[model samples]
Target: MRISVLCDVKPLLGEGPVWDVRAERLWFIDSLGRRIYRCTADGAEMRAWTVPHAIGSMALRDGGGAIVALQDGFHAIDFETGELTHLVDPEPDKPNNRLNDGKVDARGRFLCGSMDTGESDPTGALWRLDPDMSLHRLDDGIICSNGPCWSPDAATLYFADSFTGEISTYDYDIATGAVADRRTFAVLPKDRGGAPDGATVDAEGYVWSACVFDGRIHRFAPDGSVDRVIEMPVCKITSLNFGGPNLETLFVTSMAEPPLPKYPGDGPQRGATFRVEGLGVTGRPEPYFAG
Candidate 1:
């Protein structure tokens, strides 16, 4: 499929693409730039706001505003008024850790993770924030938590520990938002290219992962078999999610990290958002955080 550059701002770290079906708009963030962006489906009327500080990811709330994973904890952000309501800080003592990639699950629970600032220590972990505002730790021992999504049926959880180059699957309990039966699902190639960063499952049950530093997104079948690959012009493919009115447009985000001597493919769109269409596939509407 062909992909086109959507926005050309070239952020320091363009990540967290979320589709707001009700608003008919797309929201994402630049973690390093400390900016939150929103735009129309066609990429016009785009606008951004400089947040108080870095925000790793965010999900639209059911009523209004957004539930965001800020550097310290989760908060409710009012973009129009630039207001923030503090929620919870899972790791207040760990000053070096910050929140990372995340999304809302089928049951409207917000799922996210935290990682070390330097990205070399195994202090990261996966967390779940229930609709009642209660927080729970799901998994730990993560170095760089990246992709965290669920299957179409909501019966399986797919998460990637980027530092380990492994994507692990778990048997999901949708009612309780609990996951078990942990097993390695997909392992990134040991080449110079980086591991999987952000991922989402499609309507047909295939997992699509953006391999950061690889300049490609890989599609894996239900049985964990690699079936397709999407080549990108930029290397730091940070995250992606299916958006647009029909949920058929695949929106991708990237980082502005310069190409390393060993890894190439850094282009003008390195930190810009992308849209991939004509794939003849559709995605389910992402559930908003009910809390």
Candidate 2:
């Protein structure tokens, strides 16, 4: 409880922080600072874009622009001319692999993930982004496919495979995305450095996770227990969302390095960007022009 300071898009891998209820503001990225962040709602105006590669997630595309998932492929981020174009690179030939965490399905499609820049084992996979943009891989080796939410009547599908700390639950059928019943749903505690980064499911279905490096950001409870534990002073927090104007305010995204080699940014909660006020929860809206 009690978190503030939403205005630093240091973004050296800020992951994906969303809250774009019809352009109210807040769009994120920093994945290696390839850039992509547009704030407002206290954070004032920020706007950014430098992406050419290395951007692990993004959504919110229906008729405008946004549906990035690059690291190697899957693009379309024209916030209104900033353009990043090029939509179709799925594996391009597997130049090592990238494209992590993503969301935008309630039929709008655009669910993503594709790890393995040497994230230990399991090559990684999980995708879907049809609407002529074409690209459907859906589930694969998966070694680190962080959160991929979808469950506000989208049937039920909330994933995570950050090395497998468990956070599963699937049974969707949103017209065709199909994802039969799974299990676990929330297991955690694998020595504690935690992994399950980025996840969402509010409006009552609680299942908000971040946990990366154990800084804290949890709220599982749909039978999986533990219903709230937002701490995070910063240890590499990767993503989170639920913006202001009634969304209950809660938007975090940290990462000051620490992929292990160390010696890159030092740390101050890594790359900043946080906020957590009255987080009773309320976020579920953002899915546009699937075309």
Candidate 3:
């Protein structure tokens, strides 16, 4: 598939692309820039809000605002008024840990993971936040937690630890929001300098993952077989998801690596969002955080 530039903004670390069906818009973030953005389907009518803390990821809430993973903890952000309502801080003492990639499940529960800022510790953990405002720790020993998505049937869950170059799957109990039977699903090409960043599942049960430094998106079948690969123009592909009227368009987010010393701003295709049209597979609707 061919990649087309969707938005031209340069983000230090752009990630978390969420398609809002009701609003007909796409929401994403510049993590390092501490900004959250929204744009129309065609990448027009762009708007953004600058936050006080680093934003790892976010999800659209049911009524309004957003459930945001800030540097210290989770908060409800009112984009219109720039108001942040304090939520629970899962990691109160781990100053180096911050929330990373996340998504809502079919049961209306939000599942997210955290990562150590230095990318050198196994202190990160996957967490579940229920609609009743309860938090559950799912897994630990994750270094750089990144991707967290579910299968099309909601019977399995997929997550990745970018620092370890490992992607794993688990048998999920949808009713209880519990996962069991952890197995290695895919391994990123560590020698090639790419690590699995963020991922999403397609209608055909294919797991599409962005290789951060490899400049490619890998599609894996249900059995963990490589099904297809999409080449990208830039490295540091941070995250991706399906969006559009029919969920046929795949939107990708990227980050510029090793900022230039002289100019520090001159780079090609870095920190830009892209769209892959006609991907042949459709994406399921991203569930909103019901809290």
Candidate 4:
């Protein structure tokens, strides 16, 4: 596979790369930078807007604009007016927790999780925002949440809690938006030097996960066996997604500033977004948040 820098602009904490099928564009977030960016499939015509608070993740809306999981809660973004309207805060009681990684399900429900700002306490929970704008809690007691994706049939949900070193799967009920039968799907031991970060599933049902400190991207079979591993040039690879006209290109995001004390030696391309091609695999179009 061929991998190269997608753009020159680097973000302090780049995460959440999403491909807009309708717009044929790539959208991502600079979490610590408090900025949202969009660019053409070829990494041109890039545009950005700043948010009032730090954003963890975002998804395009079917109607228009987008929905963002900010430090406070979920907000609706008006691209035309640059207005951010607060929708709801699932965990107003826990001021120390902030919303983190999220993805839209096949039925158009937005699923996101929260994480402790200090990254020490398990004060976070996974939440779902339905099309009606109502919120539902799925799981709790998470230290850091990342990587929420679904299987090909939408019957299984895969998620990761970074501090736990395990990626878990749940039996997902698409019609009711409920998750059960939570079980370990994969594991990245602490000795391996990385934890699971962001992830996406391919059209063939294989899951691709980014190893944050390990500088590698792993492809896992449906049985949770490691199929292949691609080492990255940068050290702190944060997230990745499949984009491009036919969804053949893999777009990756990374972290730069506030370097981890344990994992040092970040290269010059530490925070740059990367474009990977020739993977010989394609991805399904991510669904727009119906809300």
The number of the candidate with the highest TM-score is: 4
**How well is each residue in 1-291 modelled by candidate 3, as lDDT tens digits?**
668999978888899999998898999998888999999879999999998888889988998888998888888898889899888999999998999899999988889899988788999999998888799999999988888999878999999998778899989899999989888999877666788999999888899999987788999998888889888888778899999999999999988643223223325778889999977789989998888
Predicted structure with the largest lDDT when compared to the true one: 4
> Tens-digit lDDT track for model 1 on 1-291?
778988878888899998888898998899988889999888898998777667889988898888889898998888778798899999998898999999999889999999987778999889999989999999998887888888888999999988788899999899999988889998877675578899998899888899998888889998888988888878788899899999999999998864234446476667989999998888778899999
TM for candidate 4 is 0.98
Ranking, TM-score, top scorer first: 4, 1, 3, 2
TM-score for each candidate, following the candidate numbering: 0.96, 0.31, 0.96, 0.98
Tens-place lDDT digits, model 4, residues 1-291: 898999757888899999998889999999989999999878899999999988999988999999999999999999999999999999999988899999999999999999998888999999999999999999999999999999999999999999888899999999999999999999975665789999999999999999998888999999999998898888689999999999999999998774345667578998889999999999999999997
Q: What local lDDT score does residue 47 receive in model 4, on the 0 to 100 scale?
A: 97
Residue-pair clash count for candidate 4? 0
Pairs that clash in candidate 2? 11-30, 13-30, 13-31, 30-33, 61-288, 62-288, 62-289, 63-289, 124-142, 256-270
Candidate 2 per-residue lDDT, tens place, 119-202, comes to: 876887888887677777767888888888866787888888887788888887888786776767887765656778888888
The segments of candidate 1 whose C-alpha lies over 4 angstroms from its true place after superposition are 258-265
Candidate 3 local distance difference test against the native: 0.88
- Candidate 2 TM-score over all chains jointly: 0.31
Predictions in order: lDDT: 0.87, 0.78, 0.88, 0.92
3 or 4, which is superior by TM-score? 4
Pitting candidate 1 against candidate 2, the one with the higher TM-score is 1
* Cα lDDT for residue 75, candidate 4: 98
